[model samples]
Target: MAETSPIAIICGGGPFPFSVADAALRTGRKVHLMPIEGWADRDRVAAYPHDWVPVGQYGRMVRVARNAGARDIVFIGTLVRPSLKDIRLDWKTIKILPRIYRAFRGGDDHLLRNIGKIFEDDGFRMLGAHEVAPEILAPAGDAGRVRPSAQDIVDAKLGLAVLDAMGPFDVGQAVVVTDNVVLAVEAAEGTDRMLQRIAALRRDGRIKVSAGRGVLVKAAKPTQDRRFDLPSIGPTTIANVKEAGLAGIAVRAGEVIVAEFTAVTEAADTANLFVTGLAPSSPP
Candidate 1:
């Protein structure tokens, strides 16, 4: 008898999904990917030497994983608004109708927990995105070419405090701050949109101006389930910060993922934006 290949399901939503697939391959684990609609890069995903599935075909998604012999399934990526209005939901998805409906009324954490439960019940154990590609999980302190300023430290502490309050509920992952004041907290609008909000607030003087000392603190909610949506940063993050005139970024170590570190770090260096990874003040 031959030994079976270790397999893991990759539910990809963004660039990190592809990066996770790359890491899984290097580990000799066959990756089964289910790419999310409107957000994933299908071409890149297909090139990665992994099995691929559609965005919302939940039933087929399970079948593919099982066929690929995956016993340890891991999810990574962002889920966009469920296309409830035009969804061709599969039986697997339909089975979770009640929870799905509730999620529409509920906020981010509510939906993620419910989805996590559904996967758990279906015999697929989900792990955080960090588990597969831990290298991208930025370490504490500086990464390259820049260090956090005094105001960046102040904003990070303030942002972490705010997230600590909301972590238990998993409502948000990133906060935009200037000086010691929070300009915006991420909601359904996401990081880029949230930064846009911060930009608006700065324009109107709702918070301190963002010429300097403005940083984005990205975090995982206290109750953050590892499988579905872990906090992430990448080249896009740097681009957004540059556009918003933010000075730096801070995220919790081991709780966040970066898509392509070289490109992201290079962009950050170009913008002179410091990127630091932090740990919870105390264990959750």
Candidate 2:
């Protein structure tokens, strides 16, 4: 029984990881949550029923899971890019590092895939965030009250197309688009900063791009793995959207995570920004 199998949670930072732990507990599963040393939100994780461990203790995680008779593990929460200087690489990670580097350099997906391989090779299964926290996964159609207008629809298509091209490259998760013109592509600066940059560009009158009075589409890369670092939007996102003078927000249907759905919608309504999820089949 999957439900009875001890579940190991590799937790990083943020509230979402705790939410997932709650979901697992609700399913009557025994959870062992390993919190990353520096990045893991300890206070939040401590509130949940779990056993915490330092980050990069791959061997310990493996051993803990094995001891608990765990066959399934889920990685949740936000992972920051840590320097090599900060890592506490266990024997397992040390042995796998070179192979992980060869896969696609030192990115989240690269490391995760390699780690997943480790589990699979050991006859354990790696589960995605959606499996444990189905409630946060993006739903069909729009999420908030404001649906995409005609122009918003067009912008969504352009954003998705660009995302399709860039996702495999793994530069970032979000892009800011208006009227089918790419305003800004999210890089190391992050989504909220990227939106701020777009707003600055408009304020300076540097670009004459017209995406209408307010409309921006944020979508996840198609190649993105849901196990770690899924594109998430929350109250801060809605606040930033409002600050950016964006009319509507669009994310790929069943792709992005609405971390704070109720608050996001409430903020969107208050800001008069349309918030909707777009199906890949929807017209531009």
Clashes of each: 1, 3
Error of 2 at 228 (Å): 3.7
Note the residue pairs that clash in candidate 2.
37-55, 214-247, 215-247
lDDT of 1 by residue, 30-56 (tens): 676666556667777667545555555
The number of residue pairs in model 1 that clash at the backbone is 1
- 73-141 in candidate 2: lDDT tens per residue? 888777766565566888887887666456435556666777677778878898987788788876777
Show the colliding residue pairs in model 1. 167-222
Q: Model 1 compared with the native: what TM-score?
A: 0.88
